[model samples]
Target: MSTNPGRVKKDEGFLGKLGGTLARKKRSKEVSDLHEEGKNAINAPLLPSSAELLPEDLLLEENAERSMLDPTSREDPKFKDLQKVLIDWINNELEEDRIIVKDLEEDLYDGQVLQKLFEKLSGRKLNVAEVTQSEIGQKQKLQTVLEAVNELLRPQGWTIEWGVDSIHSKNLVAIVYLLVALAMHYMAPIRLPEHVSVHVVVVKKKEGILQTAQVTKELTTTTEMMMGRFERDAFDTLLDHAPDKLNVVKTSLITFVNKHLNKLNLEVTELESQFADGVYLVLLMGLLEDYFVPLYNFYLTPESFEQKVHNVAFAFELMQDGGLKKPKARPEDVVNLNLKSTLRVLYNLFTNYKSAD
Candidate 1:
């Protein structure tokens, strides 16, 4: 029986013969080692065909076991002392908040919370006669910074889109907000005084390695586009409340990327930017998100409060530079542990718990 005409024979060339010989040798060497090592193999012990691992053997409760063995558990005196210090710090913070709240209650009828905040911030008390004078001084100081920012952006023709309804009214709230805008502008890790272009790269996790999936030049433009006509309104709202707009933007951006990542097989390592303004904006936002607490009850819902605590805890784990430390797992573990410790304090604040007593 002859083979079909379409059947192809193996290469009979010298190079092909040599390649085939080398491949065969490699396979034989591998099998020989496996056979030789089989009796005393560096492998798990042989198991019965239907065997299942015991719960203890699987080490699922390893953390509980380790904590029991630990000498520095919460029951230790050192931790108890630390807890006291934490409570004291929280009390101090709450005391400040209470003062602010009392002041806001007085100022709300007049819509003067911003003036009161600025007064408190400046550490000078203003009587009725001096309040306007103090506000003028505050605006002037803020104006100096705003002018500097504007001059910096003027050459580039990239003026910030001030929310027309929100900013144009020139109310005390608006002026204070402008000051915040300037502060955030300056707080940005990158100075925006010079014209700069920005680029963003989207990365994906693939086989335990980060791989670039997409690159967009002008990431701010893309984000602004995503924000659309509501950009200014959204920014105004951030300035209006305790939640840092910059933080919200960044978290929302990263979350957006991660959410859409489905089957794209990507874990976010970090979002990176070359633009000084963009980088600085991110840092400024993170700072505010972690630290800024609204004095009044308007912005103090439980969900928002919890989010602020979460953001702050997350920020504490970061290095001065925006990049996450590597190897990534260690920093993440540390952050998680710290977050748990922080949550206890946050819970106390939430429930108005004053002390162990």
Candidate 2:
């Protein structure tokens, strides 16, 4: 059909504009969708795969677990002070070996420092290697050192609470427990800070549910508390609360003294009064050692208080010379007829020579 050219051109233009409008709208919708998708992606959490977890991520997890389980957190001021004290003590002991422990976990994880410390404190050499580079070697050495430590602690009535794995894993709680036990057993001169405690959240899972509990634990050992009890004077307590027990202990001591003193024709009838003069103490020591204490060294009669003090002090010196630990009793305390002091000295001697013929 014959048509006007201008009209056909207008019609074509109108169709072209309509097509362009539709295409623009579709493109704008696609762009908006893509932008929304990008916003969602940015807002969503990115969870890495198990294989994608890095060493640092594992370390962070380990630290978090350790913090949760440890009695004292690393951030605690008391823990820091304790760490510094323990480090200083180890350094002082290992000074001759030229080993310095700056970080307890890092330095001790390898077991080299622990080996040296054990040797120094125990005065016995371990069969482990001086240094180990491999993980297996380090673990083996740790096992050996810890075995020796356990053996040493056996006689002290202490049960080991740490393992080679725990120690090798850089478990601070286990490490501190071991060190404190060693310090207490070897009688380390430093005083461990006491009553350090913390509340820890214990997490458990059961029946597809997570459970948590708060527990309080003391970081320091009860050895110091036990020592405080001993320092309160058990004999004094016995005398006040249980005189019959006191009489029994005194009778046992008297029998022990007379058994050793029978060679010198000395018998202790009154446990408290006889030892006050210090004559029996010196003679008892001489008899126990199978040596005659020269009469010139101690007063036989002890006419004055000064002479009594001298005699008792000389007897304590003899006790030390005989390989007995120094008693906590003072010479003046013994001379003043302090039953506690007298009993303490006699008890020490009795404990040592009870089996002697």
Candidate 3:
């Protein structure tokens, strides 16, 4: 492997042709020395042994020197301060990221230590919050709220029914209130829950082929029978009779039409829009449970049934006038009797009527 061609050169003549032999050896030696000098200048300390060396010895020498890539053991003192950075960089890129090392085994042989040890360490704090949610918790919450309402109404002989509802959208929790209406008395503007958007409307129903009072003449009847009471002429108009655009503030009602009506599977159409329909339904349900049911619970006395219906609807109106801003301070004194008026209407619609479509 000697590139020191002059030292290895022999003074020999081919077939004893001394002049020609000596001249060729001298030329070869000059070329070898020039190539060796250039290679050493190109990569001084970093250069591997010249390739002309014997293969076995050449590789052995390379291994004998600490590799520049091995920062921890390589004897470049400048590398001493950069071991942590080198380890981190290798972990991110070259080492396939086995960096989550949390061993405190206190049983490592020196040869088993993979990365260099840390000398200085600093503390760090992580910010994390814990959260928990469960179906059991949600069901329990619904049950607890229902139970309290039921218990409050128990003395008045009012029965309460509750269950989960299938929802196309979770925001339409209003469907939950509708499903719980076995607790209410009348069924016109089905009550709503709180904290949802809603529309309270003033709608008119006919009675006995005559124009009549919505409250007085519409009593003791389901919605189907009441609609049937209208004259054919009135029915024709009724189909088109959008309720007067009342200034409904706090009260909310969902249009029971097509995709807007179904709490599940609502679809949007270019011809019509379901504006706040899901949110409206939830809001109405909240209003029902929060305001209507409590009022109905208080007035379960026989005579109070009719008045409660009229008053609750009126209260819904008053909400627009900004009167019913809050629930009555004493809820017990204000609730009215349940005459099965609302439930009776609901049964008629749910069980007996043809599809509203």
Per-residue lDDT tens digits of candidate 2, residues 1-357?
798999999999999999999999999999999999997676334322111333433344321422244333556777777778789889989998888899998999888999999998888888878779999999999999999999888777876768887798886767877887787666564556766665554444344333345556576744334222236667757866998888789889999999988888878898767888789999999989999889999999989777888889999999999999988866766776667778999999988999998
Model 2, TM vs. native: 0.49
Best by lDDT: 2
Q: Count backbone clashes in candidate 2.
A: 0
RMSD of each: 30.0, 14.7, 31.9
Candidate 1 residue spans exceeding 4 A from truth: 1-130, 133-302, 305-357
Q: Weakest 10 consecutive residues, lDDT, candidate 3?
A: 113-122
Q: Which order, best to worst by TM-score? A: 2, 1, 3
Can you list the residue pairs that collide in candidate 1?
Answer: 188-280, 189-280, 205-266
Candidate 2: regions farther than 4 A off = 1-72, 200-212, 221-325, 328-357
lDDT: worst 10-residue window of model 2? 45-54
In Å, residue 335's CA in model 2 sits off its true spot by 24
Candidate 3 lDDT by residue in tens digits, 105-127: 11111101111111001111112
